[model samples]
Target: MFCFSCCMPQDNVNQEPSTKPYQDTKPLASIANLSLKTDSTRQRYVAEEIEKLGKNNISADIFTFHDLSVATNNFDADNLVGEGGFGRVYKGRINIQGKDEDVAVKQLDRNGFQGNREFLVEVMMLSLLHHQNLVNLVGYCSEGDQRILVYEYMINGSLEDHLLNTSPEKKGLTWDVRMKIAHGAARGLEYLHETASPPVIYRDFKSSNILLDANFNPKLSDFGLAKIGPVGERPHVSTRVMGTYGYCAPEYASTGQLTTKSDVYSFGVVFLEMITGRRVIDNARPSQEHNLIEWAQPLFKDKKKFHTMADPLLEGNYPEKSLYQALAIAAMCLQEDAASRPLISDVVTALEFLSPQPGDP
Candidate 1:
C-alpha cells in the first residue's frame, strides 16, 4: 500500500532529476524497498532501543553494525538510558566518516520474548510517519545476531518521568504542556487512522510511550503493537489480545475485533495518565482500585473530582473549562462499547478546539 502517514497524495513532491551533486533533502519514498532481514538478537535490540528513544529518525544518521558498536563502547551499561520488555537502551555517538553525531542504541537480550517481526513492524510503520509531535527514526542496523535502531534523542525523556508524584522534584508537566501533548498525540493518531494507508492502529498509546523533546513537546512512539489495517473493504482484523492491561479497549479485549477505536480506547487511558499522573496499570493500588479504568470512571464524570484527578503536583492551577473538555473527550474514547467510541479524527478536532495557543502554551 502507498504510505499515508506523512502527507496527502496531493502533496506528493515531484522533483526533476538534478544534474548537480547530491544535496540532502527529506527522505526518499522507499517504503516499497523495505523488508524484514533475519537475525533474532539484533532485531531484539532494535525493538528495545526504539521504544526507549520514544521515536526513531528515519531521515538521518543510519549506522552500520561496526559504526554502532564503536559509538556505544560495545553496548556498555554505563551509558544505559532505560529498560523495557524488548531490551536496554544505551546512549551512543558515532562520527560517521569524521562527522560527529550523537545517537541512542538499543541492545536486545538474546533470551527476550520480543522478536524480529516487531522490529520490522516498527521500522516499516515509523519510516512512513512524520509529524512535529512524533519522534523520527534516524537509522537502523541489522547484521547476523546484532540489531540496532538509532533515533533522534528526546533529551527530556518520557512524559512518565515528569508526571510521577512519588518523585520529590517531579518537574510536574504543566497544564498547558499536558494539553499540548494531548493535542499533538491526538493529531498523530488521527493521521494514522484517517490519513495513513490502511489505517494503522497504534495498539499501544500510553504515557511511557510518549516522549518529550527538549521543549517538552510530546511525540508518540513504540509501534511494536501497531497494526496496519487489512486491505480494501475489510473492516477489521483478529489477533490474540495484546497491550498494556489498563489501556486495551474492553470490546477489543472481549472480541479480538481490532479497529481504529481500539487505539482510541488506549489513547483515553493515556489521557487519564497525563491528567492524573497515575500509571495506566498499577499493581500498587489498593485491591478495590487495582483496575485503573474502573477506578477512574467516576472522577472523570464529576467536575469536583476532576480536581482530584489533576496531578496534585500542578497544585490545581489549570483552567477548569479546558480540563473538562479534555475529560469529555477522554470519556467518549473510553466507552465500554467500541461502536460508542469517537473516531480519532473527532478526538483531534476536539483537541484542536481546546489546545492552548503559543502565549498560553
Candidate 2:
C-alpha cells in the first residue's frame, strides 16, 4: 500500500533556535538558489517544494526532524543498516496511522555524492510510481538542514550483501532464490519500461540497489538517477552519462544516449554477476580476467564452457538446462548494439520460463 503521514516536533517549540556556526563546506548559494543564504531559509524552500508536490497529489508523509530523530533513536550508529556514497540508512520504527512499522530511514550526508536534486527526484518518482517489485516510499523529512527519506524495511537487505559480501556463517542464496530474485527484478524494470506513462529509464540498475525481503522477493530501489524515457519519434534521451561503472551500457557510456535498452544492458551485467559470483570488475583476479564480461566473452561463445560461468557456490545444485536458458537471456541483453538488446518485457518472459515450479527440486 502506498501511503504517507506527517509529524511535527512537539518538544522544541519553546527553545531558542541554535546559533552554532554552519560547518557544511559547500556554499549554500549553489543549492538551487531560492535564496538559501541561511539554513532556515533552505529548509523553508524545501518544505514549500514538498508541499507543492503534496498538493499535486503525490502522496508522501511530511515528517518533522524530531519524528525521524526519535524513530531512529537520534540516528544512532547502533541502528545503522547500510551506508553508501549518498549516506547511511538506519533501521527505524515510525508510527503509520495507528500501527508502528519498521522502516529504513535514508538521511543524506551533506558531504555525500548526492544532494537536494537527487533527493527531490527520488521522492517525486517514488510517489508517482508503485509496484510489487519496487521499493515502497513511506515518507520524507525536510527539516532545518536535514534531508531524509523513509522507506519500508527489506528484512534481507540488499542483493550485494548475500552475493558478494557473504561471511563465513552466511550461506549463499540458493539457485531457486537467485532465479526468483532475477525474475522479480526483471518484472520491476518491465513495469517501468512498458507500463509507466512516458516510460522511465532506470539509469542505475545493479545488485546493490536490488533489495530482498525475508521471502527473497526482489525490489528495485534508488530512483535518483531515473529519467523519463524519450517521447515519440525520438531514438533516445541524450543526457549526461552517470551510472555505476561496469553495469553501464557501452553505447550509453560512449554517446550519452540513454534508452530503456541501456537499462537492459545493465541488467545483463547484474544477471551475469548472479551466474558467475564475480564482481563486475575484480582487480584481485588475473589482469586479463579483471572485467567479468571480457573474461566471459569466450566462455559465452562455447556451450561446453558455460558451466565454468556458474557460481561455484551453487555446488552443481542448479539444473543445467535452466542455466543454459538463463545465460542465453543474459547474452541477448548484453548485446553490444543497444537496438539488439531484448526489451525488459522480453527478458521477463524468458525468466518466467526459467523460474522454478512448485515441485521443482
Candidate 3:
C-alpha cells in the first residue's frame, strides 16, 4: 500500500544524511545529548512514515540491545559468520514464537556509511515484503547508536561462497543445484519488481547477497539499497547511483536513472558468474579476461564457443544444450541497451525450465 509518489512527499524521500567521522575531541555529555536527540528524531520519523504508509501493523519484532548482545554471546569474534563494508554478521540463537531458532545478527557499525537512513529503509522494506525467496526479517534493534538486524540463518551461506570461492572441504555446486538457485533468486527479483505494491528496484544484486539454506534453496538478502520505483506514468526513478561495482549496469552507472531493467542487468552479471565460476572483476586473470562481461560478450555471439564459458569445475558433466540456453538468457540480460534486457519474470521462466526435474537431487 506504500506508494512512494502518493504516500510521501517527493522531497522527503531518498534523502541521505550527511555524516562525518566521529572526533574524540567532542565532550562526553555533548555527544550523549546529541545521540539521544538523534535517536528520538529517528524514532519519530519512523512512526510518522509508518502511519503515512499505513503499515502500522508491521510484523517485524523489536529487540533491545541487551537481548541481541546476549544472543550473540556478548559479540564474540568466534561466532562471526560474515563481514562487509557495513558491519559484521554473527551466528546466534534466539527464541522466536515460543521456539528456539538460529539467526544471523547483523550489527551495524555506528561509524559506517550505512547509517540511520539506510537502516530505516531496510527495516521498512523487509518488514512489508514477504516472499519465499526473500530472507525473512526476524527483528531489529535500534537503541541509540546500535542498528542491528536479525534474519533467518542461512546455513549453506552465500552463492558466492559455493560458486566463486569454493574451498577444498566445501563441495562445488552441481549444475542442477546451480540452475535451481538461479530460478529461486530470479523469482525473488521478480517479486520485488513486479509484485511489490510500489515495485522495488533492488539496486544491489550480486552473488554474495543471494543466500542459501541447507537444501541449496536461494533467498535474496540485503535490502539497504532498495528503492521504490517510479509509479504511474514515470519512466524511471532518478536518484544517486549506489550498488556493487562490476555488477552495475552501464546505463545506471552513467545515468542515475533507475528501473526494473537495472536489476535485470545485475542479475545477468551474477548468472554469468555462476556459470563461469569466476568473479565479475578479477585482476589476477589475464588482462583481456579481467572483466567477466567483456570476456563473455564475444563468446555469446557464437554458439560453438558457449562450452568454453562453462565452469571448469563442472568437469563437463552438465548438459551442453542447457549451457547454451542459459548463456543466451544471460546475454539477453547483459545487453548494452537497458530496453533490450528481459523482464525478471521472463528470466524466472527461463530458469524454471532449466531447473532440476522432480526426482533427481
Candidate 4:
C-alpha cells in the first residue's frame, strides 16, 4: 500500500508566512500573487479558481476534507490501491447524492510532481468534459494544504497492472478484452479531439493512465496535463514539452509544438503495447530490445513476423487477420511525420472494425 501522507515533509516551522488576502475583484491577478506565497494560500487560491470556473458548468461536489478523510479511513494503508507521480490513490466508499458509492480518492502529495496548478487544471477540465470513456470526477477537497480529488472507482485498476504483470498467478488480458479496451480508449481520445468545444489534447496517454471498470471497459483518467487544443487558424499550440517518456510523440518531444496528432502518436504507442504486451521501456530486456518501438519497427514491414510481436502470454490465440489490421493501424499512427498520422476519429473507426461482435468465435 502506497501512503502519500506518510511521505509529507514533517518540518514546516521555517516556511514563509501567508500574505494579506487579495480582493476577489481581480481574481486572476490575486491568484498569480497568491501562488508565490505560502502553500496554504496557493491551495486556497486554487479552490477559489475552481469555484469561479465551476459557477455555471461543474456538477462535481466540493467535498469537505474531514468528510473525505473519514471516507478513506484517514487514508489508511490498507485502503491504498495505486500510486503515481502526483500521489497515492485509495479505494473508499463515499455517499454521493445520498447514496453509498465506491470511489477512488487521489490525495495530492505536497512534495509530488503535481502541485496546485495541476490540481486546478484537472478540476476545470473534468468538470466540463463528459464521455463514457473518460473517468468521472465525483468531487474534490481543497482545504488548508491538502488537495484531494475523488473519482468513480475503477474495479480493474489501470491497464498497466494487467498488461505488465509481475505476478505469475495473474491472468493476462484475453485477446477479446484487449481489443475491447483498445476500442474504448480510442473512442475516449476521439471525444477529446472532436466533441469538446475548443478541443482538448490529452497530453498524457499511457497504459497507466487508462483505467478499467468491472466489465473491463477502459476510461482515460489523470487529466492534470491535458491542454486546450489550438483554435481558429492556429495549427498547433506551442508549449513546454511534458509527458511520460516512451509515450510522447517524437515531434512534440523535439519541437514543443503540440496538436491533436501528437495524441494520435502516443495512442499508437499504447496500441503497440496492447498488441505486444511489453513495457515501452525495459532495461531488463536485451539492449537491442530495450525500446519497444525500435525493436518492433523492423517487424512491421513483414506481415509474417507480426506473430512474433504478439504477446507470448497469448499463446497464439488471436486471429491473424485481426492482428494484421490492428498492427496496420498501429503502424499508421506511429508514422514519423506528425502530418502522416490519422485523426483520432479515423483510429476509432478502425478499432470498431477490429473489435469482435457478440458470440464471435
Candidate 5:
C-alpha cells in the first residue's frame, strides 16, 4: 500500500525559529504584553511544549504578533474564521524558517480568559497526539501576552457552517458527509479521552468547535476548557462546570463530576446535531422545540420517531439500521447517570460500526 498524503513522518522537526531581519517580536493580537522571563529554563519549557506538540503530527512555529499582523492584514474581517465565548478566529498564514511553505494561523484575543490556557492545552495536546480523524495544529505564538494558535487550514469551515444555515433547498451537506463527520469527530474525542498520557477530558464538544477541511473531514478544536483527568485510581475530575449549554452531560452539569463519560454525553449531543441539523439550543425555535436535549431524549428510544429528529436536508435517505444504532449509542451517552454512559472508546466503536464500511451500507 502507498501512503499518499503530502506529509511524511519525521522524528522531530525543530520548527525553524526566526533568524530574520525584523525585531518586533510580538503577537499580532492583543496578547502583546506578556513579560517573558529571559531565563533559559523558561525558554526551554516553551521549547519543550512546542516539541511535544509537534510530535503528535502537528507542525510547529512561534511567530510574534508582528508576523501575524502582517499575515492577517491587521485583523481584517475578510480573514475572520468565526467567533465564540473566546474571541473571533482570524485566518492567516505564516512562513517558518526552512520550510519555505506558508501555514494557517488562528489568532485569539489577548485579554480573553479563554485564550491562554486553551492556547497551551491545544498546543500541548494536539501536538502530541496523531490520528486520521483529528485536526492538526501546525504551531503557535505567545510572544508578549498575545497568544495565537495555528493549525492547518480547514476549509468548508465547521459542521455548524453547513448544517444550521445551509439551505435545505440546495447546497446542503449530504447524509453521507454528515455521518462521516460525526464519526471522525467522535474518533478525535475518543483519542483525547483514552489515548493521551494522563488522559485528557475534553470539556467541550460541539458542531461549531468541530472544524472541516476541504474534503469535509471534521477536526476537533478549542481545548481551553479541557481538564486533565486523574492519572491514578480516581474516576473523575471535580471542577467548576464549564461547557456550552445543551451539550454538557446531565450528570456533569448537575454534579460537576467529570469523567470520560462526561465527554461521551457531549459527543451524543454532537451526534444529535448530525441527525437534526439544529443548534443544541435555539430560541427562535418554538418554545416546545427550543430545548433540543430535552425534546430529543425521549424519541431516541422510539425508533419509529427517529425520522422526526433527522435533518430535513437528509431527505429521508438515511439507513434505518445505522440511524438506530447511532440513536442507541447517543441514548447511552446521554444517560442521566454518568456511570451508565459508554466510554469514549465505546462511543467511537459504535460510531465506526454505524458508518459506511468497505461494502454497501
Candidate 6:
C-alpha cells in the first residue's frame, strides 16, 4: 500500500511535516514559488487530459480531498507506512461497493520530483493497465496542489522491507518464496512488455518498487516513470535518464536511448539482490563488492563459483541445481549488450520452471 520507494538515496528521504491538517481545501504554500502562469498552464494541461480521459470513460474513481482526509484521519502520523522523495503513503480505510476496505493513500509532495504530469500519468497508467501482479489503483485526489493516489493496501509492504531490512525476530524469505516472487514479478514485466497495448516500458523497475501482499505475492507499483515503448519501426524510446541510480542500465544511463532491454537489465539487478540478500549498491561492503553486478560478473562466468554468490542468510538451503539455473537467468539479463539480454517473456519462461510444483513438498 506504500508509495515511498526505498530505492532512493538516503539523503533524499524527507521527514514528514508535523503540521496539522488544513481545515479548507487550499493549495499548499510549498507550491507558492511557482509562477501563477506556470501553475495555471500545468493545471490546464492536466485538466484537459483528464477531460479527454473522461470522454473515453476511465474506470478509476475520482476521490474528493475531504473524503481522503477523513480516510487517513487527517494524515495521522501513526498511519504513515512509507515515505520517499515522491511523498508519504498512509494506511486508510474507505467504503468501496458499500463495504469498508483498507487502502494505501499516496500524497505526492508539491515540490517533489513527481509533478502534475507524473501524477496524471500514474492515474492514466494504472487505470488502463490491469494485471494481478500490478498494484490496483482504487482512485486519486487531485484537488488544488494536492496530488494523492489511493491503492489496494498490500499488508506485507514492499519486498525491500522483508528482503533487505527484515528485523531480527522475522525470518528471511525462504528459497521457495524467493522463486515465487521472482516468477510473479517476471510475469508482471512480461505482461507490460508483451500484452499491454503499444507495450509499456517499466523504466523504473527495482526491488523497492515491488510490493507484497499477505501471502508474499509481489505487485509492481509506482508507474509515474513508466513510458510507452517505441512504436512501429522505432527500436527504442529516446528520453532523459530518470531511473534510480544503481538500477539504471549502462547503455540507457549513458545514451538515454531506452528500450525494453533496459528494464530487463534492471530486473537482473533486482533478481540478483533477491538471490544474494544484498543491496544493489552497498558502500559498507568491500570496495570490490560495492557494485553487485561487477562482483557477480566474474562469478556468472564460472558455474563453480555460483554458490559463492548466494545469500549467506540462505545458509545453503537452496537446491544446487536451482541456484545455478537462477543465476543463469540473472546472468543473461545482466548482459551489458542490451541486444544480448533475453526478452522479458523469455525470462518469465525460464523462471516458470524454477517454481515448486504442487506435489513437490
lDDT of 3 by residue, 59-143 (tens): 7788888989889899899999999977899999998989989999998777643455566667777766788888988888877
Q: In model 6, state the lDDT of residue 229.
A: 79
Q: Write the per-residue lDDT of candidate 2 for residues 1-361, one digit (tens) a residue.
A: 1000111122322211112221221222233453333644555665676767777765678899899999999999999999977788999999999999999999987643355656767887787777888898999987756789999999999999999887778898888889889988998898888777678899999999999998899999998788888879998989889999999999999999999999999999999999888999999999998999999877878988889899988899998978887788888788898887778876776676566645676
Candidate 1, lDDT over the whole model: 0.68
Q: What TM-score fits each model? A: 0.80, 0.87, 0.86, 0.88, 0.80, 0.88
User: Which pairs of residues collide in candidate 2?
Assistant: 5-61
The digit string of per-residue lDDT tens for model 1 on 273-331 reads 88777776677988867776788787765667766777777888888866666677777
* Colliding pairs, model 1: 42-146, 42-147, 45-108, 56-136, 56-137, 57-136, 57-137, 57-138, 58-137, 58-138
TM-score, structure 5 vs. true: 0.80
lDDT of 4 at 361: 75
lDDT of each: 0.68, 0.81, 0.80, 0.82, 0.68, 0.81
For model 5, give the RMSD to the true fold. Answer: 10.1
RMSD of each: 8.6, 12.8, 11.0, 12.5, 10.1, 10.8
Q: Give Cα distance to truth, residue 32, candidate 6, Å.
A: 24
Which runs of model 6 end up more than 4 angstroms from their true locations?
1-37, 357-360
Residue range with the least summed lDDT across 10 consecutive positions in model 5: 20-29
Identify the superior model by TM-score, candidate 3 or candidate 6: 6
Over the stretch 106-223, how does candidate 6's per-residue lDDT look in tens digits?
A: 9988774346756777877787778889999898887777789999999999889889987778889999999989988888888788777577899999888999999988999999
What residue runs in model 4 are displaced by over 4 Å at the alpha carbon? Answer: 1-41, 358-361
**Model 5 score (lDDT):** 0.68
Pick the winner on lDDT between candidates 1 and 6.
6
**What is the Å distance of residue 110 in model 6 from its true position?**
1.6
**Regions more than 4 Å wrong, model 3:** 1-55, 359-361
Pairs with backbone N, CA or C atoms under 3 Å apart (clashes), candidate 6: none
Candidate 5 on 158-261: residue-level lDDT in tens?
88878876764647777778777887787777666665656678898888888888888788877767777765888788878989888898778888988888
Candidate 4: residue 159 lDDT (0-100): 96
